[model samples]
Target: MGRRAALFILFAATALAVMAALSRPGVPQDRALAPGPRGTGPIIVAVLGTSLTKRASWPDRFAGGLSECLGREVQVTRVARANANSRWGLAEAERVAASRPDLVLIEFALADADLTDGVWPGESRSNHRAIIEAIRERRPDVRIVLMTTNPVGGLHRLKRAFLGPYYRVYRDLADELGAGLLDAWPRWPGTASIPDGVHPAPEAEAQIVVSPLLTLVAPGFGAVCG
Candidate 1:
């Protein structure tokens, strides 16, 4: 084959692979695959995220549900910052490590923003990795639970255009790092009762975030008040 033709073919294959690698139309059952500590006693869970972490009552909900399931104490410490990206999480890594949480649940809301040039996913990945490494250095036994952002309805064109790339990064990184994942967007109820499209409705929070967290936190422990 001619050299130009061969190069064209190779470029086409690479492009196709990149497209396939970056697309995540839906989530797989990866949350169940992540490793964590399912010990039989009291535990501390620290939630670090964007506004989603701040707005949702999932931490308290998880505590309540988990306590009921295990018949032991469950404490949730939230270290969330509104409008924050992964960089802030990286900066807060030391403090989070100091908190001595048994598990750190991380969710970065602005990682998918259309405004962050083309490097949002890459930046997010680096920040997340740095934070994870820092925390691990301080607390080798701590487990991390990485969660995907909740859905903004399809009508929200800005997010719909760019969000999947961020999701791709989170999903791939979770697998690569062997960290726990919670792909909460797919199961999220649409923006019905919520005031805005970004934050999930309360029912959606209970269904997607709270329930999955309860399952992960307690491991073998079963259902609780939702």
Candidate 2:
């Protein structure tokens, strides 16, 4: 073959290979898959945490998103209290367990500092461990996913002092509990994504929180584009 012709053929082969790679199964498609059935009975999803989870309106948004994605009926119940610690979260989880939720989204690490009343680090860790144990005991079959709260926007001090540790503890706990982790820390790209710095704006509904949780709950469900 001529030099130019040989080069052209090689380029064409490379392009074909690239296209094949892009077309592989499991590769996320441009179009989102149609949602499944909404559960007949209550598909309870309890979101336990501090004010951020309650005030951010994540539970409502998550229920809507999950329902749309799974095509199943989902009733998300929020058992959250402002500034409550892991201890409080476990108590709420007990109440939620009685309801027999299909899934639980745990968001208690942010309020761990609230329990730090002159206690040693070891004591705090023990308390957290006890809480996780209780949750597992109550809901052995229930799927539990840990949600690490995002850093407070423009508040470097609070982020460093409170959110940083909170994120670490949740990360560790998720691993220990063999639970899924939705670390929202890196998900918030910029201030524009969060209207009030702490709470995500309605526009960020699809990306920051919903998308991650969807992936964890239903990995092979379908594509989710903003």
Candidate 3:
């Protein structure tokens, strides 16, 4: 074949390969597969966390995004307290189970790492396990998701001295308990939007928090996009 024709063919083949790679079911592409049904009735999602969840309203956004992604109704219940940590979450586990959620999203690493809170890494791990066990005690079949939320900045970073260790507790426990995890600390491009150095601003929440959680859980629920 002529050199120009051969080069053209090779370029065409590479472009097709790239296109095929981009169209994979798991990847976000221009066209997405239709969402399949997730049983009957709206999905019950219980979110247990600290102020990061209570204030930003990502759980609500996640509910809507998930509904669209899965083509089903998604109802989110947030059981959160400002400055509460995993230790506090243990107290609310029974309440979370009482809601009879099909899925539970737990985000407490941020608060648990607080020096003033005094949770530390060991206690955080224990609290996380207890919370998971408490929820599963009543609802064995429920899907549990653990989240290591946003990294702190400026002064807040100083307060959370053991932040990395606390976040590791969630990451480790997620594997041990066979639950899903959204390790969102690294997902933040920067802390510029976190005015408080902890909670994500409204505009940044959807992209950084909600989208990644949806992407993580969507496959398990039998769908794509979040």
Compared with the true structure, all predictions reach lDDT values of: 0.70, 0.60, 0.76
Please write out the lDDT profile of model 2 over residues 27-82, one tens digit for every residue: 11111123333334446788777677777666777778877766668898778777
Ranking by TM-score: 3, 1, 2
Per-model TM values vs. the true structure: 0.78, 0.67, 0.80
Q: Pick the candidate with the highest TM-score.
A: 3
lDDT by residue for model 3 (66-112), tens: 89877789998999999787778998899999999988988888787
lDDT (tens digit, per residue) of candidate 1 on 1-226: 9999999999999966665454445654445434343457777878888877887867787778768776778888888877777877888999999999877888883444545332466787887888889999999888787887665644453444466677767777778887777777556445564557677666657666777766654443333323
Summing lDDT over every window of 10 consecutive residues in candidate 3, give the lowest-scoring window: 24-33
Off by over 4 Å in 1: 1-24, 33-41, 109-119, 154-156, 220-226
Model 2 whole-model lDDT (C-alpha atoms): 0.60
Model 1: how far is 87 from its true place, Å?
0.5
Assess the local accuracy of residue 87 in candidate 2 as a C-alpha lDDT between 0 and 100: 63
| Residue 7 lDDT (model 1) | 100
- Lowest lDDT sum, 10 consecutive residues, model 2, at 24-33
